[model samples]
Target: MLNTPVTIIQPSDGWRSLDLRELWDRRELLYFFAWRDLKVRYKQTLFGVLWAVAGPLASMVVFTFVFDKMAGLPSDGLPGPIFYLSGLVIWRYFANALSAASNSLVGNQTILTKVYFPRLIIPLSSCITGFADFFVALGVMLVLMAYYGILPGIAMLLLPFLLLLTMASALGAGLFFASLNVKYRDVGYILPFLLQLWMFCTIIVPYSEVAQRGGAWRFVYGLNPMGGVVEAFRWCLLRGAMTGPGNANATWILLGTGVPVALFILAAGLLYFKRLEKMFADIV
Candidate 1:
């Protein structure tokens, strides 16, 4: 009998660079993953895709009444509905995407155990699933804009950049939490409360109020990744007509402070996720 040669394979160290080429090579798999998530989201729902915009629409109404009417919070110069909806559109997407990504690993545990693929694809697909909702909810913003007589301006070109920032922020935080969640299921419980607090600190309130606090508070406000994203979205879609807190300089300041923090988070998340990724299969 002839002896057959054996080939040995080993898992790479956790600290290595991500294989982007491999991810690209498996692009079709990513598409299927994203499609699976999207279908699962609206599957068996009464309203189907309409459910996507419902939450943000309802939140806009409640916020307009409570913040704009009851508390008398200013919306810069823009109308309350437009201002709130503008921020809500972006906020809702980030919140939903972040939650989806955070839970992705545990949610897809069966696939993780059965197959070999880039673990990042799971969370990345979760992020993609939110785009459907994002675009759907965006229509609500347009309707509000028409009602309020707001039009897209030159700044509208910046929307793609703002969107990219939102994606990065969501994925960064999501990866960090998703990795932790595999070991500590408590992350799922804590996420809702954290998101609520995060929203209040984000675009739920007018930026003017945060700016008024001055000193370190202003700097701190800029540190919140979504703060800049919300403001930038408002600025772009509102035609730069927002006054006071919406001034060009202030928007730049928030972006200046917030962008770096977002990028830093992305870097940190990638490092951490890669470090622990090898263990996920065994652990999960």
Candidate 2:
């Protein structure tokens, strides 16, 4: 009997596995990428890492002028610079992370076409770089606190959770945008504008109390994940609770909702990313 020739076959589909574990297999790449990002970020700048610290410090001065002096917005008894800088630190980290992470895939198209590592690591590493700025902001905040003689209470313990939420939200949004960007390059163009609008929504300069006062929007605005984070940061670092009664149910509830929503968005983004990833070599 004549042997039948074997025919290799494959599926024609728009999706594949995310292969997140592949990150471990390429941990070296992640470290190198992260190092490269940190180096390039500070190398040419004369100010070095001071550039990171300067952003929040400069913004604090601006908010002190615009909101505190011009608009007469209350700082809720916290020093104006400290109040504004708290919000600025969290917002800056999230904004930087979301912006850089969203472009990680498309920005490195040559790598996408050549060898392979977990694509998520590209964005994840980029996001990690933003924390350097966050730490700088934290140091500045502490110095301002000392200058102002403000005492941060036990509420400050909540700071880490708020930071975690900010990161989760940024990562989720980044993944969704990155996936969309790979298919439609225009999304990449619009991302900066989108993040700017998002920055306002997070109450970066003005307090969330102002954002909530537009009526019925209190709860709806809480849907903005950064809303909870900014509010929580203030509560924790200001040595007080949300209300005079020392209760913080609002902060907790908002964080509860925002964290899960962020996670869901991340999961959905992964699915979407996998679905479109196969075409990157061709289209990108």
Candidate 3:
């Protein structure tokens, strides 16, 4: 009888490293996790996917009324709905992704205890699940833009990059919190308040307001990361419709400042998450 070779699997040594190739090889599992999250998200819900469209639309209406009509918050000279909805969609995605990803470890404790796949896949799938709602909300945004005859310019081409920035920021924050949540659990409680404060810090108010500071304050505001994302989206999609003073320099400054901050967060999060990945099954 011929003897066949045997294979043995061993844990990696030293600091945890992200094996991109292994993740790629397990892409099918990632798809399964992402798809499962999508189904589970809307499962048994009356509105199903319409909840996605409704969330931002309803927020847009409330903001338009409160900010535009009641408080008379400037929409950068653009119609209230479009201005508010554009920011809402991007903000909604980030908030949702962060919330879900942060909770993913505890939420899927059963799987973690029983499975051997990469732990990173869990939070990653949560991020992708959130994108499903984002795209749906994006469609609603497009319709509103058409209703107001707002046309996207060549800058609109930057949307994909801008979106990547949003996702990176969310994932960075999400990973950090998700790991912390495993041991502390307090992170889950604080996330809502944090996100609320974060929203106000972003361009839910007009970017023009931030630009008015016109110095270090504006630069500091740029460090918020989502500020850059909101401005980029508005610059790309609402350029022609915008009615306020434009600052090409401020836009560049925000993007420049934001990109580095986001990158730093991502790098830190990845390292922290990797450091904690081995303990997830035991802790969770």
Count of steric clashes across candidates, in order: 0, 0, 0
Evaluated at residue 69, the lDDT of candidate 3 is 91
Off by over 4 Å in 3: 1-14
Q: Write the per-residue lDDT of candidate 3 for residues 1-284, one digit (tens) a residue.
A: 36975756678565588989878888888899889988787889897988888888898899889988999987788888988899999999999999999999999999999978888888888888888898888888888899999887888889889888988999999999999999999998899999989987785677678678778778778779899888878878888877667455557778898899989988888889999898899988
In candidate 3, the residue pairs with backbone N, CA or C atoms under 3 Å apart (3 or more residues apart, or in different chains) clash, namely none
In candidate 3, residue 208 scores what lDDT? 75
How many clashing residue pairs are found in candidate 1? 0
Question: How high is the lDDT of residue 220 in model 3?
Answer: 78
- Model 2 C-alpha lDDT per residue in residues 111-178, reported as the tens digit of each score: 88897566778877887888888988888887888888777898888887778777887887887788
Tell me the whole-model lDDT of each prediction, alpha carbons only.
0.87, 0.76, 0.86
Model 1 TM-score on a 0 to 1 scale: 0.94
Q: Number of the top candidate by TM-score?
A: 1
